[model samples]
Target: MLATIKNISVTYDGVGKSFSSGDFISGRITLELGKDCKIDYLSIKAKGKSEVRWTERHNNTTVIYHSKDKMFSIEQFIIREQKGQDCNVVAPGTHVYPFTIQIPQQAMPSSFKGAWGKILYTLEAKLSRSMRISSKARAEFPFVSKADLGSIPELMIPQHGTKVKKMKFFTSGKVGMDIHIERMGYYLGEDLNVVVSIENSSSREINKYTLYQKDSFFARGKRRVSTKDILKELGEPIPPSGKLKVTKVLKIHQHIVPSIFTCSNIKCEYRLKIVLDVPYARDPEIKLPLVILPATQTSGLQPPPYLTLGLTRRERKPTRMEQHTTISTAPGAYPPTAPGAYPPTAPGAYPPTAPGAYPPTAPGAFAPPPAYGMYPSLSDFGGKSEWEKR
Candidate 1:
């Protein structure tokens, strides 16, 4: 008699298959058997990782470069041996095991696929039985990291670029362009406003204006790039020595991938390119960096078990892998605190030298600055303090 495994699969609990940091992933594993089966163990695993691989040719040799980083991995057993009897034997029928896990709210890169690298998130289940090949099933899902928009103030500030080209051989003057945008970062499906000021002092007729977007991916010291025209506005055909100013609007593609900088071995970036078309003359151009934010904001999630303490904020030590990757794997991890807690300073307290200055004494010293610059007020960024209310 043979124990036959019919099928195995995994499914999530909710309709929103996409996930981000701090999200709770609830799912189940389904197994179908044709007959009674004796199994050693059954388990499920969830993992996220980034990998890069490419080769370079030098002289007569080919040098291969590759790297990988494991963002997170969680594994648990659904069925295993019991202290008593009959735990390893699964009777014929459809069996389901439910599970729930929370993704570590850490600074990991978003899921991406590039020419030479990719960041992937997957769920896998396995069934093992004596004297039988293990049966396995796997599924992939999209993951967008909770972008910390407020981390960099410049992301919210306006950007400007200027370019000038002096007509030398065929043309006999100079053409200058000034471009301005409201900000460097924008959410998907948002309209990007652009202002173009052109000063044409050349002998040729200015034709039209072209604006486009380009995506670039870098991996293992090599780069792959693609460009797509977003919008093109017809110029008024400025005659020699003419000036025209126009405002152009371009919509960010809803399905485009956002900018990625957290991955060490790979990077994804975007650029806005502005061009001036002139007859029989070299066109002048301008480029600006663009950052695309996720369409949906991160939802409020419950803090992990370890962060339930009454303390408003606390730091956890980093593991060996974290030190090298520079990516925090543990949720709620923070900068180290002073040896002991300092007493709260009196209202309107200062060093007596400058108004509203930080305390100078040991007992009244201000809280240590955050690991990064001007961030994590404990209440401003992540909705609530890690454990302030609880």
Candidate 2:
């Protein structure tokens, strides 16, 4: 009978299959058999790896360069050797098996997709049969390791850079460009606001201006770079003395990796580069560093309470005296004191005096304390009188 793998389903912590490093992955494998069959064993495996490869032509010959990093590899057996027989014969309609694995806690690079590079995670289930090829089912998912930008102090401030270059070789005068970014730090899927000013006093005509987001990768000491044009604007030909200003909002893709710092063998970073294309002249370029942050953490300039100093100070608890003092002086804390600094007593109630001292209480002589919710007199607390100090 023919053997076939029906389907495979993977889940992470009762949710979607997507997961991060150090997460527990659980899934089930399903198989269908046409008839009774003999099988050796069943197994499930998971792997996470990254590979970078490219081909270059050298003197009519093609040479390939490749590098690989195995972030993790693990395998577990769903069915092992049978207790009473060399192989197990199954009369199967459908069979299902479950598996669970824990990903390592070490920093795992985010999943990436490129023309010559990929960081991938895969799951496979296989059935072994003697003297024949094994039947297998496979599935692939993405795992992302988020980089936190809240720890970087420099990212909180705005980023600015300016460059001025003099035209050379037949072109005379100077061209200056200024780039200002709202902030150096950003989260994926967030919009980046950029302000650019170009002052041209040169004879060459400006063709266009382009903004590129570059991802630089260092793997096994080999460097690979990829760039995407996030913004482009056609430049109007400026006279010998003219200026142009541009304001743009560029969106960052959510599937990209944040700036990586934990891994030595595999490193990634991003930069914002501006290029001014000029006809018959060398293009002038300016690059500024950018920090991609994880969406799991809040982005943008947070209120001052979350700043570095505030974060550190938040850990300290206020002393008892400070708490009490603050509570005592807080507005609306105590009822307002009555006029003359005396708290009115209850109706027909006379102030207590030393033993053997007669109390004086006459009708229309003392006013009762103001109705509830009204200000109390200072005498309630012994301020010149018991009622006044109350």
Candidate 3:
């Protein structure tokens, strides 16, 4: 009689189940048998990949667009007998195999699942025996990648958009709106305070304002898009020749996935859209690219606590001059000659680092200029920062 397979399972070995690049994924595989069983081999495989597939129908014809990227795959043998030996026999009982694998240190997109595409990371174990189908168990885990906001100079730059529409058939005059944001990159849980100014010189009244986020997935030169409204406000009907200004604060949802642009087969992006409702005429709209970053990112580019957009002051990268020049502050150190002290440098050169440096500032007194892509001041948000409350 053949032994019966009781159970097969995989379990993680940590308080947190989520992992990131360069992090260890430690776990165990378990197997239980009812009686002594002859085992040929047992193995575990870990894989990360992205896939996108969709079909379009034309007149009596169908077109399919599909693509995939295998980010990584690893396999390890847990139970394998020597070539000269017969199949190994396993006594009836529960057995466990522990494992630890390190995720590759490279650019990888965060785990994502969409209607037309998905990026998945999973670990599976299998047991094979003579004259029996293999027993397999699989488990999925969440993975986050370092979205280096600091390196993307554009993320730190401020953005502005304006749209004006002149009414013709249903109304008269012109309606215009100007939208401004501090920066393009925002961490999860951060509030994006959008400042909007509206001028209604038209005969029709503006009734409402809607702000929403649009998510786009791109694969094989095709795109799938979805939209979710973040904030909706009723506008006190802006009479003709009226002007209004308002600030709307929208909190980035914690459950939303971070932006993914590293994967070529699949790309995920976000856009913030603002629209004004005008009766019987086209609405005025302003759209801006949005970059969503994880709050618990592992990238070494953590920004300072006070400022929302800039990099950390303590871990600030050294300037080019600081990196190439050396200074000896030891006791009785010989001061170099004037000509040699100040090395010929490129334009916009930082002050010399040698003895008698210009602007002889005190230690820790010279604060570096704030990096880009940070939140505005508290006053800009109308009071204490909402993020600081958390």
Best by lDDT: 3
lDDT of 2 by residue, 1-390 (tens): 353434334432344435665565666556566556665656566677777777768999997777776666655454443544433565546544444554544556666666567778887766776687877777786676645555555676777778898888877788998989987678889887778888989874654545455544444445656777655666556567888787766778776666543332334456677777665678887777676766673122211110001000111222222111000111122221422211224221123232211111322111222222111221221123212122
Residue-level lDDT of model 3, residues 1-390, one tens digit each, is: 655888988876554556776665666667777877666666666678888888889998998888887777655454553333333565576665555555555667789987778899888877777688989999988888776568766678787898888888867788888989999888888988888888988774654545455545555566666666655666456667889887877778788888776665555556677777777877777777777888776432221111101111222332322222211112122122222232234221223342322221423322323222222231322233222232
Q: Write down the lDDT that model 2 would get.
A: 0.54
The candidate that wins on TM-score is: 1
Worst 10-residue lDDT window, candidate 1 = 305-314
Q: Who is ahead in lDDT, 1 or 2? A: 1
- Clashes per prediction? 0, 15, 3
Q: Could you tell me every candidate's TM-score relative to the true structure? A: 0.70, 0.60, 0.69
lDDT string, candidate 1, 1-390, tens digits: 554788888886554557886676666667778787766666667778888777789999998877787777755454543433554566677666555455655666678886767899888887777687889998787788666457767578787899888887777888988989998778888888888888889864543444454434445555555566655666556667988787877778777777665655555556677777766777877877777778776674442221111111112222222111111112222221222111123222222333323222233322322122222231221233221222
Candidate 2, superposed: residue stretches over 4 Å from native = 1-17, 57-62, 86-89, 130-132, 153-158, 168-172, 197-226, 234-247, 255-269, 277-280, 297-390
lDDT of each: 0.60, 0.54, 0.62
RMSD (CA, Å), candidate 1 to true, equals 14.9
